[model samples]
Target: MTLPRLFAIAILSLTPGLTAHAGGKKGENSGISFHLQGDPSDNPKMIFEQNTAGKQVVYRRNPDFMTKDVAAFNSFPSQDGQGFGVVLQLKPSAKNRLAALTSANIDRWMLAMVNGRKVDAVIIDKQVEDGYLVIWKGIGQAEIDAFDTQVPRIGEKKPRR
Candidate 1:
């Protein structure tokens, strides 16, 4: 079989809900929000957006998870040597919901919007049962500072109420 066809078959086998369309656009906003890819058939519930590539993509209007769901995080130098990479640990409730979302949306793309711009787009290759999401790269130091103010670093003690 052709490579692309084999790839499609593989993805379909892995994710029963897999579809042919997957893409997104940048947006204007502060902080971070992760949006899930939506099929064109979901027009009523989806919105048009532009991905970093300048390609039009359809995605859900509401993020599957957002900054409010973050409990802690860790940042690292990006492998690409361009910017930082952030590893976000979700709150318990968000973690459970993320597990369900990732489990069901395998092979779909998840767009990360930081400070209102499209910073990264990741393919949901597997279920994220641990409730951790990584923005592989394209994160600036300014954004990292913002994240620091919003959520504690992983392993850091939470302040008393």
Candidate 2:
């Protein structure tokens, strides 16, 4: 299969109750989703062909990761001053999702989404013993802020937009 199709399959498999909008309904709300993409050891490339609003875009996926338990989001200044970072805290019930990952998946990219819009992607460099995930790459402060504002609370349904 082509890369995009395979990528879609991988994403679909990871996120339950979520469907890709590439050809489906124009605006399906896929609240807070994650997927792994490509080999962790390969060079990463930005997905220019999927651009929108003239902004460069990249696709990410995590084939083995899945969850619907994002408890909260907060932003903090990057230590080196390059930019800001967003931290995702998973609920207690969802902590196992992080534990499921192993060193074999280290360096793999974790694709994050809010309401079906690709928000951010982070490379998995180590096992997450704690439920706190610091996403410091593949997104800017603006995107992080938007995510904080747009994401629905746990057990809340996303409104149609």
Candidate 3:
């Protein structure tokens, strides 16, 4: 085999590893965000998307809330034992906005997306009076780690070191 051909093969093999490493860095795509269902009506702010079940869902182009709005969080084992469930406490401003959004959009779907993937969806049955939002399941360790880095866990103290 020619030297140049061997060098090309080596570089190609390393490309995937390098790309994966870069993507794994904190604050890149690791944070969580929420999007609300949009109406079928064509609006510039809304976009069409398909959920994990392949059902067509319409949602706003921007998220209703993101990691920045989180004041703290709590994680627990899912009822079905599949993965962890997380409860996110939003900041005051985001809390009011979420309450209004949920109250106004009752019966619509609210999606929880992590690492740019739609992880779970819930129907807005009632208005959220408190600032908390729950992602029922499908959270993995990587996501938990990302959340730890981005937001503090509820009642956790700062490290003395």
Candidate 4:
């Protein structure tokens, strides 16, 4: 199978109630993907993917290593669906939904400038190449920062065993 096809499969495998937007066509199954990037010996990683239906899929394949339980604190939509100067990918009322739902582990974070001042912040830890993938969503800045801090840095060399 092609790489994109396999990548989609791997993502689908973790998302329980979520479905890929890719057209359901032939040769769409049986593909391999590296859910998380790391040596698996040090600085292990976690993976989470979701669909529009709020069905979250998760996976952890740290070879010969242990992982901490992924704690979810929030998943509410941004206020006004337009925080940080960008529209939220979720629905307008989704932010309220996140605020209402107690099961969702999500949080609200802020993008700030260096004002030489201490302000509320949120740090989402994950291998963020383009968009926030794994380490899906946390509730507040502290939660996001705490969880994100656990993610390994990109291209960071692993420690010797």
Candidate 5:
């Protein structure tokens, strides 16, 4: 392979890894990429907007666990003040912090059921809170069900004192 071609391939491959760390000020989780927007100041904002035309699943850090999961994720604003959000906890939080970036849209934030049960996919609607909202989909029904139940729970670390 030519030197120039080899160099090009190397850069292209590393591109994903580099972008993965982009704006990682919040956390580093695997199988997750988010398209965020809107300020949390508002009650309900377009937190996670989906780009794909197909259905999507979205997850946000549970508001109740904001201060709890300080290192896991951070809170922003809803920008609208009338939206709700769901938290998503990656099994291996240290696997792939950044996979691929997606486009966010209004009214794409939702945690609904696909096969008669609540799923983790947020759908990237405009009813979610701001901060770092990830839009994921094509997940199994079982996994989605789990996320719907308590994936957002940022367990309280025992008192350090």
Candidate 6:
């Protein structure tokens, strides 16, 4: 009946092998939001509006540059070879868009979401060369794994409940 409910239903209808998980405390909203950036009605760019714990969060993706699709995900050591980070391998088409992003867009914020939750608001510092979108700061293995698992789950076909 609410936007969140409608969103959950819509997601359920679209995804395959989706199941309603119970066992949590009753009346608690345990639904997770998983969506890409950008509004399909207005812009094809990466931007998404998500609801988390009854709060509305808007994720604004770069207008000039957006990932076409995630090709793969990998965990690697940081660029300085210290600590660790996640690398998002984007589709080939994303390479063209990445070319438009230069050092000027550095420090600009971009959203990296997982299951409809705002996981990381990454700020770019160097050029997003090639199709590898490296996220080192303000990210952990959990968020990376979520994105890795959930992105491919969009637009799937599940049996009617």
Q: What would you estimate as the lDDT of candidate 6?
A: 0.50
lDDT of 2 by residue, 78-99 (tens): 6666666567677776667676
Query: What TM-score against the true fold does each predicted structure earn?
Result: 0.75, 0.46, 0.74, 0.17, 0.22, 0.40
By TM-score, how accurate is candidate 4? Answer: 0.17
Task: Residues 1-161, candidate 6: write the lDDT tens digits.
Answer: 99999999898888744453345433232212213233336453455565533545444443333333555555666656544556666667766556455455565555554333344455466786677665564445565455555444223332111
Candidates' C-alpha lDDT: 0.82, 0.56, 0.82, 0.29, 0.36, 0.50
Predictions ranked by TM-score, top down?
1, 3, 2, 6, 5, 4
Model 3: worst 10 consecutive residues (lDDT sum): 21-30
Q: Residue-wise lDDT of candidate 3 within 1-161, one digit each (tens)?
A: 99999998899797866755664553355478898988778585466575645678888757899988988898999888988999998899999999899999998988898877777889899999899999999899777876787677877653111
Task: In model 6, state the lDDT of residue 154.
Answer: 26
On TM-score, the stronger of 2 and 5 is 2
lDDT tens digits by residue: candidate 4, 1-161: 99999999898898845654446532232211122222224433342232213433332332111112122122344454422111122223433433333123233222221111111233323222222212222234443344334432233333111
Q: What are the C-alpha RMSDs, in order, of all predicted structures?
A: 15.9, 11.2, 9.1, 19.2, 13.7, 12.5
lDDT of 2: 0.56
Candidate order by decreasing lDDT: 1, 3, 2, 6, 5, 4
- Which parts of model 1 are misplaced by more than 4 Å? 1-28, 52-55, 159-161
lDDT for 26 (candidate 3) = 32
Residue 84 of model 2 has an lDDT of 65
* Clash count, one per candidate: 6, 5, 0, 19, 31, 7
3 or 4, greater by lDDT: 3
**What lDDT is reached at residue 18 by model 1?**
41
lDDT of 5 at 79: 35
* TM-score (C-alpha) between model 2 and the true structure: 0.46
